[model samples]
Target: MDPRADSPDDAGTLPHVLVLGGGFGGLWATRALAAAPVRITLVDRTNHHLFQPLLYQVATAGLSAPDVAAPLRHILRKQANATVRLDEVRAIDPHARRVALAQGQLHYDYLVVATGSTHAYFGHDEWAGFAPGLKTLDDALAIRTRVLSAFEAAEREDDPLQRAAWLNFVVIGGGPTGVELAGTLAEIARHTLPREFRRAEVRDARIHLVEAGPRVLAAMPEDLSEKTRQQLQRLGVQVHTGDAVTAIDAEGITLAGRRLASRTVLWAAGVAASPLGSQLGAPTDRAGRVLVAPDLSLPGHPEVLVIGDLASVTQDGKPVPGVAPAAKQMGAHAAAVIRDRLRGVAGEPFRYRDYGNLATIGRMAAVVHFGRLKLSGLLAWWFWLVAHLFFLIGFRNRIIVLTNWAWSYWTYQRHARIIVGRPPPDE
Candidate 1:
């Protein structure tokens, strides 16, 4: 075993439980164990816990980065038992119960791995340079620049073909991210920037949502999926289903053997679990997600638990999705199991509670599937808005987001439309 790090008197006595990643799973697990007897140490490469659902909004210029992120230290300031570390994990020695960090090694009595997933290119990683995915604040900002700059480029181009290429925006994937991005892009063309540009006809911009599956939102019911397609169509988004992207380059993508001329191509298709999962020396699936026991622990290492996108768990013969809700549930369950272990009681098997699914298209259009309660249109949109606001971490952030949404609704103007990092087309 590696040498233990120097610690305070209290930290040495209490059992040290190290949690990796400050995302939904790790944060929820740490917070759930607030009153537990163990000393908790939460480590993440990034300082902020991002609200991923609204990430597309940032990419679409509807919201800023701070509106959807909160510092990890600030969130855990009141938790006397928790210590936050801003560092990345390099390796994990399960037998030694030690995790090697970029800075130093840390020994733990118990370890919780919640490191999340990243974009997957399905054996074509080179495409990543051309098709950016929305996974972090940086990715969102970069996409926002690419999107806004596309319009600027179109305005200056005299050649019709080049202009059309600049105006064509393609989102590869029909999932929630793709749907939201494509729909919002369409809205920006039709409603937000119609009067902003003098040379470019923003309304003529084409927004295409490409999906490999037969329909969009395959998780929802067929009726809701059809309704989502119809709503996207109403927003002027071209929905292309059952056509897989065979190639992606700097200029555009090729789908169904047809060349698509687009400069802004966004990826939301697939995600693979973090590479840290493989370092655990545990069995992982093809996507690199560790396969944990029913109790959310490693098969032979009960002291090591895996949750969130890093864990490959299943219930009722179906794999649990890598969604925020599932990760939160797993985090809480891991805490419960650890607490139970302290009491000499065996931990119960983890059971997931399905809370339904939701996806917003545009303006006042959305879809909600809760049990038999299926809703769409304005009612569903309001439900989506209220639910998101209630879950936001900070009151200040919630207020800012709510205010932004209200202002955008009344005036159809997106204030977070500033382009950064890249030079303007005029320059």
Candidate 2:
């Protein structure tokens, strides 16, 4: 059966499945269960499914918001058994088997909690006021405004020190997002913005990547991480390993024992699960992820399944990382289990397949680690680009993204660099 096609029994009297969050996991779950004789309702705070891997590009002006996001309603509108709702989930009453939303309640015969994650500032939540992480579209636009405004403000400042602070950009963490951001920002300063700003030396802007670990891309192989560090340095990004951020303010960041003066700070350090897991009163790991059973179901509540960044699942006694593919696999597995239960058949435990990892440093530099095999440089970058492009939903988005990437590659220009919103409300 074509899951995308509408049928007369699309509104079948099968079991009702409610999936939360329009991210990778929830979207995948909805797709996997499309052919099943079940009514599906997908809920999220936002109305779009974000291609998170390319969110940094949006923030850095490489791609527009629409290029990396697709409307949720448009995606599942053809599936007769499926519906989309834009609402914030306030709480989950597991005993009552109901999800409380800001507007009303949703009763689920089978629940899938794929609420995803948010940036964690350790215990120093105040730092978030200065160093905003890239998670949502608003965060991307806010960072873009701060970045572009720095150049505008620099042009007006006569004091050299103040201008330097405006030109300096600091990114916390050495993960994929941080590394990609630092590299792209460096390119923008060195290649793109220099022509736009005549008065100030945009090329002289400093980009620093601060990481607590001894090396960048610590999750990857050792050699790949070392190579990435070198590639980033070649792009003129100051790589600071073994350095932890102590404080962050509007002026700058305090790392190790020294103070770095900068007006722009991007936080990509760590992430914690969404508050929905805690609301369920389920056992969570250190990262605040719900600990689920082998079948991706809450303990003693087989009817409810939790996957993606919100749930902590183990395979071969090792915990799964909160990545896109992992989430997709878990979501598919959860849907299978629900289908089996509806068919009066016992379901097997969910198993996650290791699908390697990839992180790109700059335009043609990347690192990929697939089990024991590792590759670096341009080849890895190509792989990364193709993988991301292949995963994005809809042909129109794929064409748009490809066009944007090709344009950026040929001209070294970012088209989505426009600054929106009112100008700081006039001091």
Candidate 3:
């Protein structure tokens, strides 16, 4: 489809598209452009693409890391024009249409920047050490280790206050990830650990879910949010809304003008766009997200595109929510634009379709909002279970996750609750 090409046979020498990140955005864009004439080079810091929504299960020791991730090369192996590179992008050169990597540089006729977002500590980066966020496999494993180690440490301590500190688990942020982590932690303490603990009464462990917002799952309908909040409380999660954390350290967190003593804290709070957005040399929002054009391209640089959580795009005067569906839709739109350019046709402006929201509390409890339909309790949980399993990347992952869920559902036991690093060797 290149204008300079004498015929279709010469299209292989046409444009080169460079896609950054292997999340939902970049992966969908790469697959969408499969039949296009351009050659695609997908670069990401990690070799495997992670299913972030399921990462909570790993953090809570319900699933292993491998159950939620798949190799990028394995995904694109069938695409003849697609190549995967496990490299980190350092900077972007718009004039040259190239990206600077740690080891080398890459040039592209069309660049898709979908590097996604990272957990933000709200200008309190130091709090990161105490309240680790679950965004990667390492983060999940680290949290698992901390949670399990806390119980083990408590077993050795005889002082009541020290044991209480070990059993106090505080989760900042009431979004889906926070709620899930808090709920699963409650399940583990109230069910799994109680059966295993010999000396300490682990069932007395306190789990708190604190949110600065007015309600949990603010993105969802108010009724559903309230429903989810109720379910969490029923499962023994202390829900604190309209509360902000002022500080976090080895001891615990200070929130709502009070100090809570705890050794393990999980952060599922606010997120800022990945630092890669600034490399585009474009205007970015306060959270460091690039403002994209109507067609999902960088202003004054149509060849350079930004999507996913890194780009700020609005529909009906509302910014597109940073979710897997929205990211995939934006990626497809960007691919369509490139396909249009190849046919010498101008692409239409991007439009986002609004889908409903879903949030689960614990086993057999969830909330869902789909247009006029609203559901909660066990029915919604079933829907949530099916949707996530269907969206999982690999057949093996789906099977493993389903097996794990069934095992937990029947026995109230977590098979993958083993800790990594710093733990005693099996031998």
Candidate 4:
């Protein structure tokens, strides 16, 4: 047992601010408190802080794992008052001001819960076995393997129908992740893998994007949604709207009155808050997100703050969207509140600043909704690329990602297609 883990600091004078998860929210909060008079500890199951916005690029083999993630310790190496722990938090005793970890226990003066959310199966958890969701690097690698392996399976298949099934791909949810995935799959068929397979004509592959709502990108303007659908269709992706997935199995999924025979089914439909939120004993919505106060703190527990996807915050009758930007704002607010408390000053309520949204469909196809300034097509694509590159942490990561995107744009080849684990055997 390390002596430092027992209390705030070895000297036991400074207040300790314990941050859960190394995602955008927690990372921002920890950095915001770099000059504060407190001891900071950031704990996460994984060692690296993942840039989740471009996580799909990794799944589609457009970039490698290292390009989108940086080690938490490496990120906070210069922060003398901060400590990074690569361990999962097992339990939190808010009343006791102690947290139970998988390895040990820790005490803290303040706790920020930014554990984030995971894929929701909507009461049909069994569908997860057949259709995987993209959230982590592991999920991305698994999907990449399944997608690449499906092509390999088609090459070995003798029957035309079986080969067609192998070539068929279905993406659930018309949100940004779903749209991006379906579009990239179409590009892979039409441009990336057409010449690689000798027996199978990968160009004949079918990519389907299924959305339960009336249109894809439902959060955007209706005209933009229609444009996104049109762009997806132009990329050879079959866009299905207003049809929810009824059933799913190893072979395919049943939607409405039709069954789609597909070998790879990717899920991007929904997300539920982390189970840790429920453990806090706070009021939560149907999705298990804690109904945090205006200050992003638990109702009865001012010392415990919940932010990011795990927190359900409403501003002026509008619910704050669970995006990276909102999370970052909440994190910064948490830091500010802590600093104010140190100076015997009252903290102001957290007010979210909407920065707009960006979604890229495919090559030279994208849509940006920044308040009244709407842009689409090639201009939006370049804007999206530049915005992501600028937000991506670490100089090396930005350079490597830029180089990879430039290379892929010219050659239509994804270099990080190496499969680490053995893919599922063909049935």
The number of clashing residue pairs in each candidate reads: 0, 0, 0, 0
N/CA/C clash count, model 1: 0
- Candidate with the larger lDDT of 1 and 3: 1
Q: Give the candidate number with the greatest TM-score.
A: 4
Give a tens-digit lDDT track for model 1, residues 1-427. 4344534553567888999999999999999999999999999999999999999999989999999999999999999999998888899999998888987888898899999999999999998988999999999999999999999999999999999999999999999999999999999999999898999898999999999999999999999999999999999999999989999987899999999999889999999999999888888999999999999999889998899999999899998988899999999999999998888888889898999999999999999999999999999999999999998999999999999999999999999999989742322
Q: Which of candidates 1 and 3 is the stronger one according to TM-score?
A: 1
Error of 1 at 104 (Å): 0.8
Q: Between which residue pairs do clashes occur in model 3?
A: none
TM-score per candidate, chains pooled = 0.97, 0.95, 0.95, 0.98
Candidate 4 lDDT (Cα, 0 to 1): 0.93
**For model 2, what is the error of residue 198's alpha carbon versus the real structure, in angstroms, after optimal superposition?**
1.4
Off by over 4 Å in 2: 1-12, 422-427
The local distance difference test score of model 3 is 0.89
Q: In candidate 3, where is summed lDDT lowest over 10 consecutive residues?
A: 2-11
Q: Over the stretch 13-35, how does candidate 4's per-residue lDDT look in tens digits? A: 88989999999999999999999
